[model samples]
Target: MQTLYLSRLQHYLFCPRQFALIELECAWEENVYTAEGQVMHGKVNSGGHDTRGNIKSVRTLPLGHKSLALEGVADVVEYRTDEHGVQIPYPIEYKRGKPKSHRADEVQLCAQALCLEDMHNCKVTEGALFYGKTRRRHAVTFDEELRALTLEAINDCRYIIESGITPKPIYSTSKCRNCSLKEVCHPKIFNKNAKAWLSNQITANLNEVRQVNNNDD
Candidate 1:
């Protein structure tokens, strides 16, 4: 099995074809949204540490789990003493946009929690996602459902990526508006042209069959 990036799980959840396009086809084009996200990540990726009382924040911490075969860096891992005075790890992800209609962001954060759980051999029950647009931390619970979904996403990503095939793009103005690869993917144009070409081929084949039948008669 190929090692998958934990980050790609969110992309796969968002759109499997988008995940394949980038991970398998090595295609990417940055739009304003993606650019902003990169900028936010850059600040955290530099690596830093801060302490306040019993809570500590570590930036850009490396995380991976051999069982899941996924690897990536968590944007932030906040540590705090629990009721029993034991330090607990809480993974937090930073996003450029607000909460979407999907659970991609939450799945990504949960994947980080899973990694932390694997590395530390402790249960990670929750995490947080901080959105720059909202300037609020959205807490995510690593419940059974979310963990199952994250595992499903990881498996799907590995299957799609290892096959080395990019799936067809489904165009939606609203969805594609913020996609950086919209121009390269050309979802609308590509599907339109494909349909046109298929129609032409069928027409020509019918004509050829008719001519053959007439000649035989």
Candidate 2:
């Protein structure tokens, strides 16, 4: 089985079709939001490690879990010493924007925490998401609810990937408007007229084949 990316959890959560297009079909496009996000992650992963009183920060740590078949590079993982003198792994994800109403970010963070737990063979009770826009850390606990949601997303993505079929687009003004793949997705145009669109595409391909045969003659 291919390793599922932790980052792709957010993609699937936001839109399954988006996840399928990028992961299954290897389709991508960049817009201002994604560009800024890449810039933010670039800076975050620039090996800018530092040490505080009891915390040592590690940048761009590659994490994976064989059992879950999930992997990704975390932006930052802080090793914080507790009163008992044991260090705990705390994941911190960097985002270019503020938090949204959806649980995508939270699920992504939770998946990171789960990977850490699996690799370290210890409990990672919490993690944090640092938004560049807000300049604040939103701490997420690995509670039952969040963990269940994250695992569900992982399973959902696994099924989609294994099927090797790109999901049909379902548009939403709030979510699809700023999507980088909006033009590629044509969510609004295609989903509404799915049958007609498929028929037109098939007809165009048949026409191309007919032209090719004529040229061969």
**Quick one: best TM-score, which candidate?**
2
Q: Quote the positional error of residue 73 for candidate 1 in Å.
A: 0.6
Residue 153 deviation, candidate 1, in Å? 0.6
TM-score of each: 0.87, 0.88
Instruction: Residues 1-217, candidate 1: write the lDDT tens digits.
Output: 6778888888787777788888887888877888899999998778988999999999999999988787999999998888898889999999998898899998899889988989988899989999998999988999999999888888777778767778777777787777887877888766566778789889999999999999999
Look at candidate 2 and tell me the lDDT of residue 19.
98
lDDT string for model 2 (83-157, tens) is: 999889999999988998999999999998988888888899999999998999999888999999999999999
Compared with the true structure, all predictions reach lDDT values of 0.86, 0.92
